[model samples]
Target: MSIAQIIGSRHVLAVQNLHASINYYIDQLGFSLVWQIEGWALVQRDSISIMLGECQDDISAHETNNHSYFAYIEVTDIDSLHQEFTHNNVEFVSQLATKDWGQREFAIKTIDGHRIMFGQELLF
Candidate 1:
């Protein structure tokens, strides 16, 4: 089997404020917390999973160095999600717009400067 046939995938993020970040995802955005550990937490929605790794002691040094990459999640409604982020004072970089790839998406910046793009497939 090829790598594309992998059964599961996990997207990890190195967070400076684990509790606050978890709250933003679980409480504000409505993602369910699937698992939690001393310095890690996993939030899930359908096939998407967001893993939070605490960076207090640099146990996950490799992940911390990869903060420049962005995670794009597929959602049913982009506008509603964007509104929730705006209402909660989340630092989003842009409004929902159609991309060259024919997908409607918006970007939100986390506290540690990671850009998460929420995307929806374009019908037209």
Candidate 2:
């Protein structure tokens, strides 16, 4: 009832370059291509899907660099994830660090410069 009360969550990014975006998402981050259309594709990690679509024709409509949004994903092990990222040569914005919020985390920027923060809960 009432629109199913939000079944799941998803994030979408608009890109001028689709192939490169897909490559970075799939080849680097281990996301799988769930679906693709003429100018759009959906990449999934676990049950979460990120929709990457072609940018609109209007240049003004495109989001500017240094002003993009980032995604924060909760992972089980920060050390393991950091190792994988290092092995893959993924450019991490920062090395793993503990936050005041009781999360151990690191940040990375995708090829398109969208940031991703991988975090784990801090143990006592």
Candidate 3:
């Protein structure tokens, strides 16, 4: 028997307001709206897709402390991407820097307080 290959993934996030989250992902974060219903939305940029579900009563990601990080996206051109995010006035959790772990990375916080890290592997 042959093993099945895994393809892709979509990160599901519980947001306070579905409409605002969708707008942030689309307008601020450069993601395109894949689809949206009453209480849910899907947004994507390149290969990264996020599913936002409205959960008004739930605690926001910022309150989770260190546990708030959701995704670490690998990209090709880290500098350009960082510049773009900076230009958009995105709220950054951490500034772009090369780490000893062989990755150049940065992190940002969404309007709903979800955190995502973007990185590019260092070519040593």
Candidate 4:
């Protein structure tokens, strides 16, 4: 694919605590804050950008997640990412392992209970 064929991507997530969520993404995952105001913040790590909005609705994170992942991010080195998050004491839903589809994968629940899976394609 050419550069014009693909654009950037962003994921909007509802977080219960604005400050805490921003801090988690910045400090834990090494994401840099692009901008923040009122109840919204935009953070980025490399080419990926995620928007976190504070939610006041009458719904819990457990209800929001409900056994569903919020997003799937492709990573270059899944093991290094898992190790980095693990070093930060991040809680994981699944330890790193190759899936049945032949991709190395792992899952971690964010502070707001957003489950994000990271994986890399296996050439073999």
- Top of the candidates by lDDT: 3
Relative to the unseen true structure, what is the Cα RMSD of model 2?
2.7
User: lDDT of model 2 at residue 64?
Assistant: 58
Q: In model 1, what lDDT does residue 77 have?
A: 80
Tens digits of lDDT, candidate 4, 1-124: 6456556779988888889999999999889999999999999999889999999674646586555477789989889999999999898998999988989999888887888889999998
- Residue-by-residue lDDT tens digits, candidate 2, 25-120: 888888999988999999998876899988756342124555554578999878998998888889888899998999999988777777788899
TM-score of each: 0.77, 0.85, 0.96, 0.89
After superposing candidate 3 on the true structure, give the runs of residues whose Cα lies further than 4 Å from its correct spot.
none
**Candidate 1 residue spans exceeding 4 A from truth:** 1-4, 57-67
Pairs that collide in candidate 2 are none
Q: State residue 43's C-alpha deviation in candidate 2, in Å.
A: 0.3
Instruction: Please state the error at residue 74 of candidate 4 in Å.
Output: 0.4
Best by TM-score: 3
* Per-model tally of clashing residue pairs: 0, 0, 0, 0
Candidate 3: residue 100 lDDT (0-100)? 98
Candidate 4: list runs displaced more than 4 Å: 1-6
Candidate 4 residue-wise lDDT at 124: 80
Overall lDDT per candidate, in order of appearance: 0.78, 0.82, 0.92, 0.88
